[model samples]
Target chain A: MSDKTSRRTPGPVYVGLDMGSSRSKVVVIDEAGKLLGHAVKKSGTDFSRTAKACLDSALEMAGAEFDDIAGAMSTGYGRSNVGFVTEESKTEIGCLAKGGYHHFPEAITIIDIGGQDNKIIKLDAAGHRLNFKMNRKCAAGTGAFLEEMSARLDVSLEEMNHLARDAREMIKLGSYCTVFSATEVLESIRNGKNVNDIVKGIFYSMIRRVLEMDSLTERVVMTGGVVAHNAYLVEMVDEMIGRPVLLAEYPQLMGAVGAALYARDENQSAGATTAQASSKGE
Target chain B: MAAGKSTTRKKIQATDLMNQVMSDYFYHLNEAATSGKQKVAWCTSVGPAELLRALGFAVHFPENHAAMLGATRMSTELIPEANSAGYSPDICSYLTADIGAWMKNITPLSKAYPGIESVPKPDVLVYNTNQCRDVQDWFSWYSKELGVPAIGISSPKNVVEVTEGHIDDVARQIEALIPTLEAISGNKLDMQRLRETVTLSRECSELWKKVLETATATPAPLTFFDGTIHMGPAVCLRGTQEAIDYYRVLLAELQGRVEAGVAAVDDESLRIYWEGMPVWGRLRQNSDLFAGLRTSVLASTYCSSWIFPSFDADNPIRSMAKAYLELFIVRSDAYKERYIKGMLEKYRIDGIIYHDAKTCPYNSNSRYGLPQRVEADTGIPCLVLSGDLNDLRCVSDEQTKTNIEAFVEQLQERQ
Candidate 1:
């Protein structure tokens, strides 16, 4: 009885804590399936401390405290760390399914990019995702390279988008490493080629990885922090995937929202089952 | 290392080196059986240690024996046992050695040498699943060959420990194992003893997890690889007081180092993942190259294979039984993502150097675009350094070095 009391009783409100390879992520959702409020914060280098900070910040942004939250969940590389979060914490699959379903009920593919991994999930019309393909281990065409190359180019992310969108010709930089990309970018600048061309090449390379999905159907839902920041990447992915990439209104908040949705479902089911059992005259 | 001979004539030379181990083995076996103190050992996938100590009514592990054949300097000779058994030479060397040992029926009954002919043989066999699927195939053969019951802990694909349902599965497996365990130890299935063992092992494993993460902070207490081997005493001889003591010392060393801010590598310029298995022949040199860069493999899919948290203690038996379902190497795509995210979070890995192990299909075969995927998801740059995991002849030491040097330069540039 004490254990039951100590453990969180299923309640309304859910949160998503995406423990990423490069960063941490969080989101919140209220009961009746409403997005009360959401926030995005950088994940930490040290998970225990970093995740704690990310969680705290998200809670503050939601205009509440951690105690105010009725339930919580986490996903990403850091899900295990969130094992202590709640019993209802779902895997990235269920979160993405929930978020993607909420965003585009017809969405079939859900793509998420974090600091160090990328995934192309295939969802059904109900946003019920099927088997998905992911490339979290490899970094050839991921956001890390883009961020690295952007740093090397000494161009701000905003400038990168502006320049990439305006590039005259996309030079096949063929530079896989950000180190090599930097060298190539610098050399191209030294050789009097526009830095924008190299930046375009870098974005295209990352897009190539995302577009490699075998069954990338229409209604693709894109999530993760980078999705909101890099429109060029989204646009390129859209063109490359051969479909207008769907966006969650709060792409970064999807994981958290999904998590909160899970929490709400847990409470709803618990309440319904208990109501039925009590009504049965027990 | 002394070249201990195959035949009896060289026994004298081998005497001084292994006399202590042989003496202890015999003494413990006789004393335990006579005193009716049953000893069982848990298995770690990477080394021979834990299972070796558990022999004689205690469980024995072929996995560690296989690791010895893969990683030891003398891997060349002992490893062929796998190839002789028709296993691919390019497979995990440990599996080869394990398969070879199992096929030979070299249990506790098998005499260690002519000197200690009285060494009691291992009565029960235990196996650990590697992140590689081959572990399942390898152990299936062991089960068939030994005819003695073989207990296996299946690795899972899903990471969430939501329900205690896994405990139910674990309990079922443990229930089946009781009769075999009883038969081997010549003791009845004592429920109290099982509970004690489970409680102690769970405590020990939890400590190990704490110790592993303790090294992640600045001046990391130890490299993930060292911890992988050091974990030997716990996973192998767990369910005993010794395991508790061993962890205390190890944890103390780790905590001391943490307090002192003793970085595992003094000048770690970068931390990289060794994508595939090390080319067995060039293990030292390849490791050295990284050490030069202060880029220790803080966590790797391969090295972290043994570091899984068996936290679902509500049911210890099935938890142990279902343990394999979580091996990062063997899990499905979704499972791999979960592990990747955890690794990046648990260990402060800056960059990754993906090594496509030369002939190890199991180690090498992964999602083709994972490097990019990882980079995008984590925002860390990855250098896809194409090198085979184990074919020494094909990999060029110099070329690999140049690539590593360049990769480190990228990390340094970021700093």
Candidate 2:
């Protein structure tokens, strides 16, 4: 691929980094708000390094280099750790709302299940956030809880989602605590319950938790790494909420996309300021 | 040598005065027993401190001490002792910390005031049920341990209007305490002194209200964290002339900042209201987080709880009854909702952050459906943050930061 910056009008390119708890993602967007490229990787011990790697991979996918980027923004758990974010980074909830609204552009509710937390964001008709609720102090009904249950059942996280989808009967786990639910899974195994049914129960608990976080509106959007890998979870949420759930085009990269949009807005505002200064000098 | 760091946030100058006055107050309490002239009384935050003052007793509030422990992050260290004493972890943190401090023989205040090993033992314990039932039970437990008589005043709950009968019910209870107080302190209740003390308390409350009102200015001159710390005077020294004088100094400083266009949050883009008790250990962190986001938490229900608009100096007992009975935490849900609505409009609040304090059931219970109600009624968004005033275990800084940041973004979107 040839570099198009010199031949073209040198349009601004924005990069967004989402340093999530379990994984980090980065996305590159052009001046027309089109996704150029994106990449995702596990977020290891060093968030800043992982964020840099994710951005590098995304830039490579877009056939571009770091010098081609005009602005950068960051979001998610390690938002402040990103070195390239020139402007203030946004929160995960804000990014989720922005990402969902960018897709739907109407009154919508977003349910985001991440490694250690779950968030429910409500947006108005004009794509403005009205309110949001988050489950932070608990590990139950989050991606981490599902991972723990997978460990308890001696299965991989990916396999648990597949097994849960194939189950004919679903077990209903009563406890909203990860430790207690782990014990309950063991008890279910002792009672000769199917492992698939038990895994489905864990998914139900997660769906119940996200649904109970707040009141859902007409349009519902589901995003995050958990839903990105586990399509059955959105099916369960749709069945429970009694409506079809809209999935983000790049589910795991939604936060990064929202951050990219923010970067583009910042870049335009800066450009406007420079233009005004030059016009005044004239 | 590159030296001084550049800073933009304007720190409150009143903080210095607050520390000085609080230090002197604790130092005076440390010497109260050694001086041998004044008997010490342990009172609740909303209890009858004016009456205690009129009877010539130096008073201290355990709630204030618990708050100090909370702010100093010492409550978690002492909580295990309370747990060892068979108190469940689910109980009020203030109880656990206060009782745990007694069990472990630890006092954070002593570090500030030298030679003060613990809180001055009470000659008599006094509490009121206006805030919560925990105060009564907490005082009773300590009273039993110390082998001292305890007096309590119960206020009527769910009253739409605070009637004369309601005031009389609490007034009688307070009047019954005079004999016990006079007998214990060995000093008669001087009617003139009681009247004077009540007047002073009224003046103090009015000044505190004005100080809180100064946040109404753009880019609020006082943040809620500052209010939480400044509340030490109102809770510990409300009836004292020193408390009156201290607020006068504080109000002056706040007025000066407002005129000079100095802000608690630099370049504040949004103003929000905090509806519950602060996460005491993380007050500065949370305040700075909001400041970093260009959001100013201008006012709160917790700090405004001390504002008594019903004080009648002529009828001291009845007025005290009326004033204490109408505390924000003691009122019904409808009254609280209306009060919150009024505060939202008065302060031009862009959002509300409701702290769902884990151990404080009385203050935390109303937060469940109240946020949705406020959003529907006022067209203002509400974010519920699950945290504890004293227990750091229940609070997640990452979660709270994200929630508050999103709330600010929502406000910006609306703008």
Candidate 3:
């Protein structure tokens, strides 16, 4: 409730803000890389305001003040707009790879289906990125696609997921384009196709789209707000990939977590450099 | 790899002379078009320009003009005019933009040169399909519209090895064009003149190759962006002494930079090989983006397409046929892979970026699993960027910037 600049605390905490297109998420972590608190809010037209609000709520939960923050990093579509980040904003691909590796600590492929884009990042055992791919200049495999299909199906996003789970026979939509698939959904409704089946088909279409973007590694970790809300999609991906996949503790907050980890790592390295310089002077 | 410190790129002094050279070249073409004293021949960028020169004709390249339209950002507006006239949007934007500009009675040339109303009107339009069949269709459309004789050589496609048979076929085709060229120019083909022109072209190509090879030095003297611009002489004035002379100047400037340790991109820690057509509309933006990231795009398949190692003045016709046939665009995937691998090693390239040009499928090499194969064989990473050579509508600036940044970060991590 207090102004951020006026508050003071005793210890240092790192901050990571994933200012994505659909949502702004902030994670507060201690010096030991342990998550202290996190917050997520809708990222409307004004990204800067949303980022501040998420940071305030997250800091409040962590019982920390502005003076306690050691370093900060930002990622995602709105990263550049976040004025408070101390480090150069990283790409969502790098943040995702770092966050995913923190969880598994091994060679893993991170699939992040976000609001307007989807990413598949591959990282080695040492947390170095091997390769990464983002969906081409189309909205087909992202959360935006699901929202459009849900709107056409006359259901809320949550209702669509629930309906998908209830379907006995999955209806397959033929078109990959979000607009064309809406028309196909209308045609299915005209042909007396089951609504639940149609909803399941939409989920299947989204999963299929991401699958075609790139081949997956053996250890696949699913993250992002889409999978966080629509758990059925994760199950579908598992079924499709023919293996169990790891899910981050907070799927939508993984990029923020990754950004926080970067802040911590960078701060420690700077401290080591300063210590070495001072010791040499002595 | 730590990020390189940002510094202003060293300007190549030859650009001033290149500007004058280009202005004079266009001035002569306009003079020929307006004065009606000499015949003006429209040739493809990689067509037999030496032969055209020997036959006593002033040359104009539409591909060069289309690139100007693209660089000046005029193609996006004019392309619709051609699309409205039934040219598919999926074909080469170079063809569509050129035809579209012609339909609109506009050109980037008019603005660059005072008193020039449009591109030089052709007395004869010649094409070589070694690049693509689209050039033949493009030239044919203009031929029908202007009632000019359109002559072309149907060079073999997906050529793996340029056999003597292929050379003979193309040689006879070149020989076949003489009658029409003589009729149009009101001059006969002079073998001695042709041989002289071929010699000039050979010298010019070697100098251009040396200019590009200067990037093999640490902290490369020039970037691929520089090559794309400085290549103007090599592409448009290949058969003339002016081109040979201009390259000698450019080569010396580059060599001076290399000796003095001046780099085109400051702190050039990462060296990259660009594997497809330059995103013509976004050249400055892309160039600055890479420079800011401290990555030097030192080599590319597109700019090197003009290098004709096969040109031999002693056997001008057959060697010209061999040179034209051995073009990189016409080569098979296996041969292309080998060529790219060699370039990566030659340039000490740390990474490769393939621009999957939407309209230029012939030049876009990323679609056939070439990127993965190269990465696998060479242990160098590759990034595929989806864009077009001339169509700005197909390119996503924000997406491309993010991809390049991430690719640089990935490479840095490996280091």
Name the best candidate (by TM-score).
3
TM-score to true structure, per model: 0.48, 0.94, 0.97
Candidate 2 ranges with C-alpha deviation above 4 Å: A1-12, A84-88, B1-11, B365-368
Against the native complex, each candidate's DockQ, computed on alpha carbons, is 0.01, 0.49, 0.49
Clashes in each model (backbone N, CA, C under 3 Å)? 56, 0, 0
True contacts kept of each: 0.00, 0.72, 0.44
Model 2 - which docking category? medium
Give stretches of model 1 more than 4 Å off.
A1-282, B1-56, B99-121, B128-133, B136-167, B273-283, B301-314, B318-330, B354-365, B383-400
> Over the stretch A132-232, how does candidate 3's per-residue lDDT look in tens digits?
88888889989999989888878898787788889999989888888899899999999999999998888899998998988998599999999999888
Full ranking by TM-score: 3, 2, 1
Tell me the deviation in Å of residue A209 in model 1: 18
Per-residue alpha-carbon lDDT of candidate 1 for residues A1-282, written as tens digits (9 for 90 to 100): 011112232334567676666667776566776665454555565665776776666555555556667767666555657655553334564566677777677847788775665666666554544444445335666667667777777887667787888888886766555566667777887888887787788778777666764556667778876787778778987787677887867777676677667676766788899999999987
Clashing pairs in 2: none
* TM-score of chain B in each prediction: 0.72, 0.96, 0.98
User: Candidate 1's fnat?
Assistant: 0.00
In order, the Cα lDDT scores of the candidates are 0.58, 0.84, 0.90
Model 1 C-alpha lDDT per residue in residues B1-415, reported as the tens digit of each score: 0011122111112223234433344456545544557653323453222212322345444444444444443344444666877887767655665555445544322343333322223444555443555666665665566454556444343345424575465446445555565566556754455556656665766666676777577656565456445555444455556666666766776687678776666655566555555555565565555665566666666554545365344654555544444445655555565667667766777776566664455565343666667666886766544444333334555446534554564455466
